[model samples]
Target: MKKQRYALIIIDMQNDFVLPDSPACVAGALATVAQIQKILETCRRIKWPVIHVIREYRADGSDIEITRLPEFREKKYCVPGTAGCEIVAALKPASDEYIIVKKRFSAFMNTELDIILRRLEIENIVICGTQYPHCIRATVYDGVSYGYNVTLITDATAAQTPEIASANTRDIRDIGVECVSTFYFVNNIAVH
Candidate 1:
């Protein structure tokens, strides 16, 4: 087997999602910024790939998921060419890092993420992002289903409420997916 390479997959930490008082907000999202940024710094230090998975939609909302299409048509959370679509300032992608735009919850759904990861020869994916029950969970499940070693950084992800976040992380842990805290991952995985 080939050597196992890894990448840091940051999902949907755009202005619309993480910034406080945005049109739509996940209350716990903003709290994760510091941890995510710290992990990004480690990835940069190690020269590991950082794949930023964002969400962008057309003005007419043609590309949005059905569940979110109404909101998109009305408010346009992450429309292309808009400030909302851009990644949060604190966790900005460097010139060398990659950005993957997806219209759905899962970064892998209808996106080139798999192809890019394959091309980069990434075998282990460490994920951290907003809204634990939705985007983070979906991406983690998809990564595991695709046979990649998936790790979810619990402290680096959040949901609208502490209860929701706890439930989601418990469910995620109940599954076979590896779940770790930001401190544990940074201490143990950064050198690999």
Candidate 2:
């Protein structure tokens, strides 16, 4: 079988999740910025599709789930036209790159992500970004359900703590996803 085309899916690396001063900030989210940037540069050099998945909720909280509605309203996270919703400075998508706005954890949830990926003829999804337990894991599960090969860039995806990141990586790997560090992916790009 031939190696399938890959698209780098950077999930929820938005200002609200990554910046320390933002209300929805995950404790270690910003740590993965450089790693994401590194892998993204490699993807650009190789002409791979880069899809940036972001979370943007309505100010009225109608777009969010019942469980998260209260916190989202209180935190005012990722509201439209707000700085919190913007992609963080270092990892902003290029004008031509695909930027998918999602209301839920999985990028495929109520979004055109699957359609876009299909149109681009992508099979292997190289995923990296914030809060491994939620967004990253959800997207990975959906990617598998959609029958695409999934590679989790472990070091480039952060959680609240190192242990949390490690445990989630292990769980995702146990399910047959390729779990690797940003360095591993970058160094092996020549073969990819």
Candidate 3:
């Protein structure tokens, strides 16, 4: 595929999901962070658009979707006022980066992510982050639905186990998103 103006939409990279010690943190979350850092560094060097999509719930949980699962529904994980809502320091966003705090699985749902991407004229999206079955999958579908050429950096996203991760990755590919590895993406970008 030809390179276009792409936005790196990192989904749910907040402390609650990314830090290994976080209450609701998925196992192997820290490893995903390391992969994200590598992508972030390359994006910075290449001057690509980098957007961090966080899930910041309301303090009273009034704004949350009660229809979702209990793990995500009733629990107030990334409450807006709490530190768990903040992006991890390892992948701290720079001044030029875009930060979008969303309330749902799809980053474009009731969020500024779509507006930001449009303003940047970004037609391609390179998606990478935690929990492949959840936010990652949701964001990829939304990216495609919203008319962005979406690609999932397979090695840059992870869940609790390799089996689940592989299955999730396969599901994403079946939906028509190009699922490529981090090494393939970064190496090409480095030499480009």
Candidate 4:
């Protein structure tokens, strides 16, 4: 069998979501940085396409979701030109890598992600990064809906709590998405 063409997508690993002191921090996000970094390194070594998907909003909250607007006005995050909107330093995209900025939970929503993936002829996507229930879940489901094989690197992804992560993982797996740890994914890639 031929090795499937795929891309590694690192989603929402930004200061606002991953830093412990950031206003929008996800409790478990900080811990997954290292795991995400590991996967990033492996992908870079293997010369795989790496796409960094990030969330960004206008400082005035003009582009923020209507449901999040009230809170966002008070506690702003992921604002453009701000450090909080940047991808965490540890997993910064290389000069040749792609960065997709999204204003919604799903990276594919109104973004050029699908176009880029299609242009690359990518059939599978290995996803990782912060907060499972929202961004991760949305992106994974959308990937499936778009007819792409999706793999969620469980350890490289995070949620506010382990319980939340576990629950989301089960739900994601039930959809036939491959959910594996960073180690397992890296090893499996090696074997192929």
Best candidate according to TM-score? 4
lDDT string for model 2 (1-192, tens) is 866799999999999999998888998889899999999899988889999999888899998978898897677888989998999999988988999988888999899999999998888999999888999999999999999999998889989998998899889999999998888899984257
lDDT of 4 by residue, 1-192 (tens): 766797999999999998988989999998998998888888888888999999989889999999999989989999989998888888888999999999999999999999999999999999999879999999999999999999999998989889999999999999999999989988995244
Question: Among all windows of ten consecutive residues in candidate 2, which has the lowest summed lDDT?
Answer: 183-192
Point out the worst 10-residue segment of candidate 1 by lDDT.
69-78
Q: Which stretches of candidate 4 lie over 4 Å from their true place?
A: 1-3
Ranking by TM-score: 4, 2, 1, 3
lDDT of each: 0.89, 0.90, 0.82, 0.91
Candidate 1 stretches with Cα past 4 Å from truth are none
Better of 1 and 2 by lDDT: 2
Clashing pairs in 1: none
lDDT rank order:
4, 2, 1, 3
In model 2, the runs with Cα more than 4 Å from the true position are 1-3
Instruction: Show pairs that collide, candidate 3.
Output: none
What does candidate 3's lDDT look like per residue over 62-113, in tens digits?
7776754466654568888788888888998999888888877788888888
Question: For residues 1-192, what per-residue lDDT tens digits would candidate 1 score against the true structure?
Answer: 666799999999999998887866789999999999889998899889999999888888777789887776667688778887789999989999999988788999999999999999999999999878899999998998998998999889979998998888888878788889889888998777
Better of 2 and 4 by TM-score: 4
- TM per prediction: 0.96, 0.96, 0.90, 0.97
TM-score of 1: 0.96
Q: What is the lDDT of residue 47 in candidate 3?
A: 88
lDDT of 2 at 174: 93
